[model samples]
Target: MDVDGRNSTIGYGASASGMTDFSRTDAERANPGHDTRQSFQGDGMRGRVLAIALTLATLIGALPVAGSLWVAWGSANRARTDMLDGAVHEMLARYNRMSTEIDQVFDDLSSLPLAEACEPVGLMRLRTAAYFSRGVREVAVIENGRILCTGAGKSDMPASLPLPDMSEGDVRIWYDRVPPDVRAPASDVARSTVIARNGFALFLDTEQIYDLVLTDPRTVLSMVSLTSRQVMGVRSRPERAMLSDMVDRFRTDPPPRSLRVGNRLIVAAPTADGAAMALAAQPIDVVLEAWRQQAVPLGLLGLTSGAIIFWLILTLARRGDTMGARIRRGLARGEFRVVYQPIVRLSDGACLGGEALVRWQQRDGTMISPDRFIPVAEAEGLIERLTDQIIEHVFADIGKFLAERPTVWIAINLSAPDVESDRVRGRLDRLRKTHGVAADQIVLEATERTLIDARRAQSSMRSFRDAGYRLTIDDFGTGYSSLAYLATLPVDGLKLDKTFVDSIGSGTPADDVMGHILSLAATLGLDVAAEGIEHGAQADYLIARGVTYGQGWLFARAMEAETFGAYVDGRMAVAGPPSRRRRA
Candidate 1:
């Protein structure tokens, strides 16, 4: 009656002084195990579905970040490979030029170098060869431990030479050999490389092997001997152990081109002649930098996608929960039942009629309260179907009983949508004709809230009244209940809301309002039915105030069709004699 049928004119009685005893005894006496049969078992299934949706959303959101991380790692590796390839390209270019220059120097000195030895002609040829070659710093003649001649002038000093660092067939190469200028500081002087064959040697700076200019200062470039695994020339100082490890790893039969050592990445490329290897070393942070650049957008995209998916699932789940889908299923399964609460005359306690209330007991025996599903039915536009079902249940349960007892009437609560349509009237007409029940015996009750659009409700109430049906404004004093508002509607009676009735002796301001409501109903010449009357004092007060009809636990709680019929029959017998009266 109150939006969700919680305060429907015809539902089970609320707890008062005597309702506890009445509810238990009436339920057990009328239909055993009926009260214990209803539950909210579907809640567990709904909870699990929600939990699963949340977990899936979380996983879905994290997937993109995971994929991004993988992509970032790949990007970092590619960057390292590019750096290695660039370093290798530069080293190969310089090696090619140095090799070409050395060949030219050898050719220039080949004509007269060995025979002339320390002579003027040999010295002149050496100076000319040194001048023609860009890589060669000096062209000299050496034999055993003695320097015979030099490109600049005759060399009288002893040739201090050690075993060659690497030997390729007839050629011997000295890496980082001491320079001839002893006056220069060791740090200031560039280390030299000496390549000797026969009685001749070409003096070249070790830097010429790998003269690198890298964009990343953290990068280190070194030239390593492929055969001996020796680091020959380095552009930057790196740890000796790391260099050794790199050499050991790259010294395989076909050597690895790249590898990671500790926090550094090492890349190697063999020179064209295969005599030297270009090694590029850099910290792992370079790879991380690449990863960072790519991770931010991917992570955001993943998070965004995850959030959207979660919202969609949650929306769908909530819709499934509240869209009255389950209510429809419950209806199809015949989970709904109809019960009646007696409405008696306050003066004699005579059971004149009763109000029909709908109860939904699921297949599992769990009862879904009308308060939980009635508003959902209205919101989903399924109130008409629910009303039709209740009407059918009412007639099916007590049609013949009502026919035999013509004076007793049953009030059925209606929703706002029901008042707005002619469907209820049509259904009522068909049922009344089919069952031979008088239209006046079935009263239609609408709460004051249903008449928000006064003109429409006035017309609908008038139509029902014209069809010989009793119409009452139920749950009065709870909504629009001003004298002006009530006077405009066509209704046979006014049903006082439980709030005002409960305030009868509470000494609250609402108690005063109840008097005003009774006065208004009397002034409008409408019969009054007090709902939720439990105590004797309340009934005495209503009777004294001229409230003709009253219903609550003081009389009887809502009961099944058979029990209600039995109660009516017993009351009729006790009342005796025939006293013709109009339905209240």
Candidate 2:
């Protein structure tokens, strides 16, 4: 048969059996050319092989990324646990100090030869004991919960003590107390924790018990009485339900443990005496944030082995995932820059120095406000990196200028975590040494909130001052602090908050506070710098009140390093020194 006729008649039905012959042989026989079944099987086998190859490739590509994510998550969880453990350890150390002091005071008081506690000799001995005790504010002799006499003197009247908050055998504890003859302000006297036993009571400061340096700022520390389920002392405000649950868990004096309660991770340890417990609580989201921070580098490292498609998707997703991620990327790309706001003498308007303020600008020429990104950086524990970048940029921008002008000082803001850590101080010292910048020429500024642990903050600032670096409190009066709180911090100057300056001459209650702040600064002999002084009247008011330094729009807004250098040059050319101008 011809090839065309055979092809046309292929797979035809109705053979001798009068049934359709649907076999592949019929087609193959009619054509007498290729094997149709073999061709079909070969194509199917090729498809199966290709699918298996793709599947294997996908699994191989995903393994690394999956491993990275697992490792990152594990590290984050371990970090959270470690942080909680640290906080608990710190609280226990505090408790140990307090308990040791209590034991010492009780022993000293017990050894005193006292016939009558209300008499002159006994009062003198009590006073001497109180003088030596660090935690004891007052030592008193009590009878049936009534104060008979104290180190201050004999009570004019018998003052009845309130019922104890925690009573265990012979020991009694009052969580909050205000005894008679506490002449200090009501606020100061309200936080006293009284521990009484064997006819004597020691009025202890609650701060001694609860002032802990928590690893995470959001972590809350508290001392709770396991028996009474009452909070003996607390550092920051805690959720009501969380506190209640925590107290309930320790009713039977459980051993030290870390457990998740609702949305918080709580690490708790009991006091040595088993009467009280210390707990540190942090949010779960904070832990997840820590995970995200660790995941960035890990994920990048893993993506090298991932499929090109996955790499592309991850890159695009991370590009806009979070502000923290954006900041991290921005820092890597050198998108952060510095600007200087001139600090001038209120008397002559001659620039004495400038404050280094950090600014962020993306590659696309988009400006991100400090108010927006700063909090994100803080929350993500990237503030130290941001501060490092700011410091580097500052020195690069104006290090030589500062070296030439001995009188000019540039103030740099320090975040709370920076104040808590030694990294920033070390970085600053190295930069100063490298750039020939005088320690005094660069002022380190910390806000009131930076004093999270007042004792530690004081020690940190003292180290700075000892190194000859000046310290200033920025944004004063904006936090939960008063002028008196300044005495606790080792600082040379304070920048009045803009809100206080804006309320200048507004005849509001804040005006009164401003007056009080000025008076307090003057009394303390602290250098006062008024911020946001936009009006002559405001400047005049501050200058008249003896504010020597001021920075605001009245003199000039923040400018780039080049502009600021020219600004100071022009100011010096016109105004000269106050002494020189007066002589002229």
If scored against the real structure, what TM-score would every candidate get? 0.49, 0.57
Tens digits of per-residue lDDT for model 2, 1-584: 01101111111111111110001112334444331111112244345644555665465466676687788998988888888777777677667756766776787678664457768988987886675556678889989888988988887797998788878789988976775586798776557788998888988866855665556688887877777778777787678788787776755535546778899988888877777788888999988998899888777766665476455544443334357766887898898887787888888888877877766657665566444566677767777788888899999999988777666778888877777777888998999888888888888888655553456677777888778788877767654332445556777877777777778789998888888778877767678887777789988988888887887777886778999988887665243222201100
Stretches of model 2 off by over 4 angstroms after superposition: 1-158, 162-172, 175-223, 227-319, 481-485, 573-584
Kindly list the per-residue Cα lDDT of model 1 for residues 1-584, writing each as its tens digit: 42111243333212100010011223333464454433333466677878887997787677767886786678778877787777876676667657756765675566774867568877888876675455778877877745667776675566578878877776888888765534678777787888887778888855865666567888888887767877777888668788777777776878776788999988887777777788888888888887888888766656677778789777666544543767887777777777888888888888888888777766765556554566667666677787888899999999989888787788887877777678999999999788888988888888776664456677777888888888887777665223445666778888887787778889999898788778877887788988888789999999999898888878887888999999987776344222223222
Show the lowest summed lDDT stretch of 10 residues, model 2: 14-23
Say which candidate scores most in lDDT.
1
Query: After superposing candidate 1, which stretches have Cα over 4 Å from the reference?
Result: 1-323, 573-584
lDDT, each prediction: 0.72, 0.70
Clashes of 1: 7
